[model samples]
Target: MKTTSQSRMRMVPTITNETIIALIGLYCLAVVMGYGRFLFTATLPDIMTQLTLSTTVAGWLASVNYIGYFIGALIAMFVPQRTTWQTLMLWTAMSVITTMMLAIPSLPIMLWYLVRLLAGIASGIAMILSSTLVIQSFSLERRALLSTLHYAGIGVGISASAILTWWLLSLDYHFDVIWLIAGLSSLPLLWLLLGIRPDNAADANPQPRSIHQTYINFKRSLYEAISGNGKAISLLSTSYVLAGFGYITSTTFLPVMATNQLADTYAGLQIWLVVGVSIIIFNPVWGILAKRIGEINTLIGLTLLQALGMFSPLWFAGALGLYANAIIVGMTFAGMVSMTLNIIKNMNPVYSNLLIGLATLAYALGQFIGPLVTVALAGDNDNFDAGLLAAGIGLLMGLGLLLWFRQLPQKSV
Candidate 1:
């Protein structure tokens, strides 16, 4: 009986190191992207109410966070490869600290700006580092699937944030307490992160390089890639910018929109929750679909779908429109990101780092501008109809660029 049991156990497959690394990446994203970054979105309506903040001020606050994110991403692009793990840990710690700071009561608006900005920076650096860690650890054959799993962390984090917000609201906890609990909740994950050492062989004896050298190399590679695939790369980057602008308006204000339209806080929160759930459930499906179709096709389709989702609220009414918007947008946004980066990387595998870095910067700029533009379009009445329409138009323009790029002849890098 013992021999038989041993044999059965041997037949079962054990989890691989790549799987462990992917899980670690997921946790990192969940905490940083989901809680540290997006918790603001989930709690924005309440914060606005409690602080009596104007729509313009609220938009500025959100834009400040993205500005920090943009700077952090730019910083990450030049960070020495050898220090990625340490940098990730440092940023993760910062993320935790900054999140907790949001709990301080009656903080000055400038302080609020400073805290959110720091949190955004932390989230941005952690995001880039964690993604790099996961991708480098896995082999090409398994990369796509593992990456999908890693990206699922965004959805997991978003969903968890939404749920926690909903629960706290139900318990009549103020936004401060919610932020406190959210910070405290991440402590365990931080502890777990310490145990996740890099198993990649390259990490064993990494060569040191100065940030200046790294930047020069990256700049040189980027120039070569653009020189070779100028039109394709330009179109893709511009599309990504529009995508960043297109999705963020809804991402930031969906809950607030829900509360306004439905007049029910719980229902408003539920819409965000549904988005998280949809992202978690459908993100992997896109990876599978990409295998059957192609990355470009998948990306174009996603962009089109997202554009339609952006326009849905204008056409549909009440909770129905909000839910539709949430589900559709959630389903495509993350996939769009993964696909775009993948496409660019495939264009010039040697220069992929710089290519992806450039794409990310463009996306970040769009996100930084998105809320400010949306709020400006929203005007004194705080009506988002015009903003939503503009967002959809941006997506459509992006889609058109993608189609044009698709028609271009493929060139080997």
Candidate 2:
């Protein structure tokens, strides 16, 4: 047996090969699981038509995932930090994949809600844990790079789901067929993750001093983060809620709205596909820009772009509007998700995890509220004009709140 002195020497380094593998694994899972969460949105039209779902029911189906997600955000804290990332991802992905496969649009609303809730919980756990896994596994220096890559997966997943949906719809395949294909993709990923293990989940960055140490370095870090954004987080929460309300309702109904009162609707899925691909390029650009221009200003630009994209439905009737909206919305939406994290990080590095959880909550809340609000306005005909008007109102409200966000005076560099 090794001596106590020898054991101490072996535990010195902060990062290892296991850390790198975990990063890549997290990145891949981000794509796979994201596709799982979002495929429903991508295939909403088919789901409604085939399952004979009402607008409210369909919106709830999509929003239910967020409800599960909201619950998962709280549940995540209870999970042992020392748990294996592989097992965590595996279990989470399985949860998403299983209910997703079992989902029958023809089923009663109650059963449908249950599946969405379960999926939300699973995907929520996996995504939150994945983000946590990357942060915990790497040193501070590489965290930003990893974050950029992380949201990039959302881009990839969006593109894949769009293209896949388009391909199936074009081939005249049934909507259920698409779900089967999407769910089966997870099986191979699960097999690949069989041997992978995660690093220690304990507070690796704990201050080097004793438990009794007052204001330890780690605690100080938390203080600075909380201090910087304590009030602002509340503001951030409000901004995100409004933004989520407007953006989710508008974006969720994008393809549908674009097709509304228009005769040309041939390539909506393809247009959405292009938006996904654009994010692969745009997310990193926004990241670098956020680091330079600061998060507040960059976020303003991000929201503005989304606002512009939202206007495409009204820009011109027919396919022209959709084509324009898809391109603009896709690009900005990509940045919004990635940049939100950057914004939270710049405000407070120590509470990044907590903030992430909070942001997730805010976003989920936005989803829950957005659909209900939109459906109410849409009336019985499924016209989203009221929702769109409310969306504008929400965006303006978010912009006003953002002006109050305290930060480094909108940096130029």
Candidate 3:
């Protein structure tokens, strides 16, 4: 209804309302995904009993989500150019909500598997796309603050789920209720987000990369990360895979690992909560440091620290050792989740999501394989010293990849 010049003037952000709304939407999606994910993990024993499942079957069922995640990220290329970030977020919220409502103890195993995989894929695309939007929406100076807060969503969601689980489990309530509650909570968030759309994606009309190009870039990145193809292509891909294994081992297996090291009866939810709280506190600190020193150096130093934290408790068993390991490992590890995308953004401004999708595939593979491998390594003792050691190797591999990336020409990354 307005003149063209007037419409142009209105497009300028005077109060930054749109960006703030988009970030809120991001935080909301994190809550849904984080809660859904941890609730299942923390309540696995009960789920196994109710569903009459074996360990391998359960693992496959759980990991199906990661498979869906990879497929969804890969398919992002086919999404229409007119796709709005809001639409993706809305779909994610809806998928989680519906899946939870329909999820039941008597549901068929294959059906359960399908839902989990689809949910994982939806959540993966939503998370990655939300992150890209957050980065592009803000100025450089405000980025650290926004990024730290955005990353904190997982921690916050985990914390919320932890508290809810504590109350529910203490009262002997079923986990299905928790799932229903998680899904319901997200509905309002989506409703609140109905009017918001990302301005960042509005200006950028990047052509989607072909699947072939994705593989080529990923192969090149992987080759460089591992073989040091001497292009200094950002970190080696194999090493990144290993490091991802190490990081996931810490988050996914650390509670069980702690039980072994210290011989204490720790609840998985409680352990996850402590880890999440620690991450919430430290992510901002890391972001500030990254802003000052640089994301690359911060990544290098943190990876080393993460490696040490992985095996520390096993090396010196005690309450203090376990607690220290939890704080340190949780504090440093998710940077992998956040940083890889940031690094890809730095490396190829053009093919950022494709690179992110490729990197996420490596990460998903690491997570899928890492926990199972750790379980195998634990063997008779159910002691994860062997797993911890393997994690160290993975961390070293990831560090090597990061270092290799840094040495490459700035243009290469």
Candidate 4:
């Protein structure tokens, strides 16, 4: 009886290797991209009080972070092949260091900019490296599902920040303490992600190349990525820029908007929490939907949904509208990102990193531009109506780009 039972147990599938790698990737992203990169926005209101910052200054700081992100992506595109593990480790450490640096009370605004900027660079590199390695660990058939699970980390990080900030603030923790807590929370994730390696077949048996050869290879990949799929990449880049502008403007100001409304002291928290929850729930839904309906069609629908969500709060003007806006915008932003990257990956599997890096660069540019313009338009009155309208229009422009992508020939890429 014992032998028979053991045999049955052996037949069952336990946690697979791929599952472990995916979890590590997800955790790394949540820590680095979610906590390290975005926790700033979650805690911005509190930090603003401590720093005595103006809206315009705060917006410019945010833009500085995006600029850092763009530079990081540009660097990642040239990262010599087969060094994914080293890249991940270095950037993950930078993430931890930068997050903790923000915990310093009474720091100069310039220091804050530098810290956040470094965090953004860490996040950009970590994002592409983890995505590339984790996706490589899974089979082609299972890639989409695992990729969605990986992207869900962003939402998970956002939700975690919201809950933690709410609880800590309720307990009367100061801004410095909250930043320290967030930094401390990321420590364990580093150890957890230590085992995830790039198992890419192409990278498995890497041959050492001279510096010149490496430079040549990098140039070749960049040229191939652009020349091979110029039209598709061009369209994707424009869409990414619009998406970044639309989403960042909404997210950056939502908490401030909620506070100005004076609806409830915790109203902003609740709304941000809802946005995070919706993102977590919808990532997989859109992933599966893309599988069924095709990525192109899914992108078109989600972009339109996002545009509506961007403008909904201004149009409806109530708690109900705010919640609807949160759900729609949060749900669609990540889906649009996932679908867009998937399409880019499909366009040229070999140049996936180059393409994704380019897309991220475009995204960073949009994020950089959005806040500067929004803050300028929204001087002391806390009025973001004009900014929100512009965000919505940006999404509509993105929708037009997606339509254009669809109209191209089958060999467009």
Q: Which stretches of candidate 3 lie over 4 Å from their true place?
A: 1-15, 22-26, 49-52, 77-81, 84-87, 98-103, 199-237, 256-266, 318-321
The candidates, ranked best first by lDDT, are 1, 4, 2, 3
Query: Per model, how many backbone clashes are there?
Result: 0, 1, 6, 0
lDDT winner between 1 and 2, please give it.
1
lDDT of 1 by residue, 1-413 (tens): 75684455455443448888788788889899998878898999889999999999999999999998888888777665566767888899999898899899898999999998998888778887777766777898888888888888988988988899899989988789989988898887665555554434224345667879867887876687677788788889899999999999988999889988896758767888888888889889998888889889999999999999998989998877789899998999889988988888678755555567678777888899899989999989889988899999999999999999899887722
- Regions more than 4 Å wrong, model 2: 1-33, 77-80, 84-87, 103-109, 136-142, 191-196, 201-228, 261-266, 345-350, 407-413
Candidate 3: residue 60 Cα off by (Å): 2.4
Candidate 1 Cα misplacement greater than 4 A, ranges = 1-16, 199-218, 224-227, 350-352
Cα lDDT listed for each candidate? 0.84, 0.65, 0.64, 0.79
User: In terms of lDDT, which candidate is stronger, 3 or 4?
Assistant: 4
* Top-down TM-score ranking: 4, 1, 3, 2
Worst 10 residues of 1 by lDDT: 197-206
Write one digit per residue (lDDT tens) for candidate 2, span 232-252.
778777888877776776557
Query: Against the true structure, what is every candidate's RMSD?
Result: 6.3, 6.4, 5.5, 6.1
User: What digit string (tens of lDDT, one per residue) describes model 3 on residues 55-132?
Assistant: 566557656766776666665533432454644665567566644753466667778787777776776676666666
Residues 172-276, candidate 4: write the lDDT tens digits: 886678778888988876665554533342234466789899889888888877775788889988999998998888677777677667468777777788878
